[model samples]
Target chain A: MSDTSLTIRRFADLANPTRFLALSARLLPWICWLTAALFGLGLFYALTSAGDYQQGETVRIMYVHVPSAWLAMMTYMVMTLSALGTLVWRHPLADVSARAAMPIGAAFTALALVTGSLWGKPMWGAWWVWDARLTSFFILFLMYLGLIALNRALEDPTRAARLSAILILLGFINIPIIKFSVDWWNTLHQPASVLRMGGSAIDGEFLRPLLLMAGAFTCLFLALHLGAMRNEILRRRVAALRRQAARGALTAGGPA
Target chain B: MSLDAPHIGFVLASYGAALAIILGLILWVLLDGRARRAEIRALEAAGIRRRSDRPVDDARAAGPAP
Candidate 1:
């Protein structure tokens, strides 16, 4: 077979939950190890780097706070794509992926908020303020929670998946606002220093470890997401078996 | 690293919170997988297998639903 076709064939195989589970089982262990190693390296850099003249030692908090915030946003983007997969492509694992991503995204968002608050209290004089940047990010976090709650309240998995997909897409308007709030509004939150229009405002002194931490946290997100997907697939399998058992019981019994 | 540095407590608290959240997520995923696997094993052991797990020949022999 041609190489392009062969690759396409391999990619197509992952649409099967069993195949995806097998792939995740093989990939997750290595990703987890890589995440740990990268975090260790990143931490070493973060600790050894000299403190900022203005921010002093408190700057180290950025190593954790920034990455968590990035992951919080990235995971939601992931869900947005998974939402498309469910609505457009109708892939079996699309809803599974979206459902699995919600809690992990929520956790990361919570981590971002907690760590941001911890960092804020020292620098900004207050743990939080009703600024555009902070308020929008907080709303993003709440949207995740709302979608999670919506997913759980519905009885049928199919209906829940469809409704959650719509809600997720509807809720996605907050992402760009969160990204641009520092620019659109004169918030106390510092303007985008890393991914700004004219390149990073941060110096090389701090950028290295920040990127490493970002990489590590991204890997961590993938590791957790894959494991969660595997578990969801298995949970569905268990549910299917229970339904089977119930049907068997009904069939074996006489009509009421 | 300096214990006496200004605002060091905030840095420590942030890192501590990050560590706590990461560990919680890891445990949640791990324990959830374990519980599901155990449940599947119990169900299969009780002769309650998935329709896909049943053979096509057996399914054919059993015939259609009433």
Candidate 2:
């Protein structure tokens, strides 16, 4: 654990069961408090301050809907990076980190789909569409589901890690397509407003709360992710010990 | 349309959905952490008890009795 090995040390800390448990003990409470405060403020802003000039009160939906959608995309990208880390660096935490992120990502993706649908019904006169943005997002959701299912189905942890990592990497291709689909083709889904060639399409009044809510959501994700990783590390350790005990019992009962 | 005038049900639904998902994730994390910690404590206790029994068993097996 020299200075040169600090990166390795950090990885080991994350990978080690007891170390992770100790670290998470100090982390979870702060994360929970920060997440609560941020969400509270963000909700207040969304409810009290934001109002759509054109879309009217309904525009408040954008605060939650937009941030969740952004997080959904961003979460996939993170999982992909973790997947690569697992493959190349053989970082033990990488697999558990990626696995821990799946359900959270899936939930965000689902929220995005549902909220987008609610928004669309009023704006587009329809609840569902096969438009490019929507379709690509649908693919993103399926990818999350696939990664989760793949992780659970394998018995060997390392084998499961490798397989799930590969799946996450492959599925990440959908993210860029989802982001750019609106511009590359004519789709019912609107083009990027908060981000654009010139500037945001949103006004200052609305943008402020939207940005705040997004920050809150990102913090919440980080907090939840650390907690989930702690649980995964503990579960892996328990499972390994049980396996070792079972093998010992078998060996002890063998013919002399 | 005025600021107050528009379909409001959709807005309510979006908020509801966000709340449901976030709360569910939080509950899952808390419950999982509690259960894993309990398991770890149990496993450690078992390991300690087993270790304590080992020396006694070894001494009896190596006893001087005929």
For candidate 1, write residues A155-234 as lDDT tens digits: 99999999999999998899999998988989999988999888999989899999999999999999999999999999
Chain A in model 1: its TM-score?
0.96
Tell me the interface RMSD of every candidate, in Å.
Answer: 0.8, 3.3
Which residue pairs does candidate 1 place in steric collision? none
TM-score of each: 0.95, 0.88
What TM-score does the predicted chain A of each candidate obtain versus native chain A? Answer: 0.96, 0.93
Assign candidate 2 its CAPRI class: acceptable
Q: Give a tens-digit lDDT track for model 2, residues A1-256.
A: 5786998777677766567778878987887788788888888878887566677788888999999999998888889889998999887788888999999999999999999999999988999999899999998998889888889999898999999988888887788899899999899987899988898988887888898899889988988899899889879767865765676577679966
All DockQ scores: 0.85, 0.43
Off by over 4 Å in 2: A1-13, B1-4, B48-66
Q: Give lDDT: candidate 1, residue A10.
A: 85
* Candidate 2 lDDT score at position B40: 67
Best by lDDT: 1
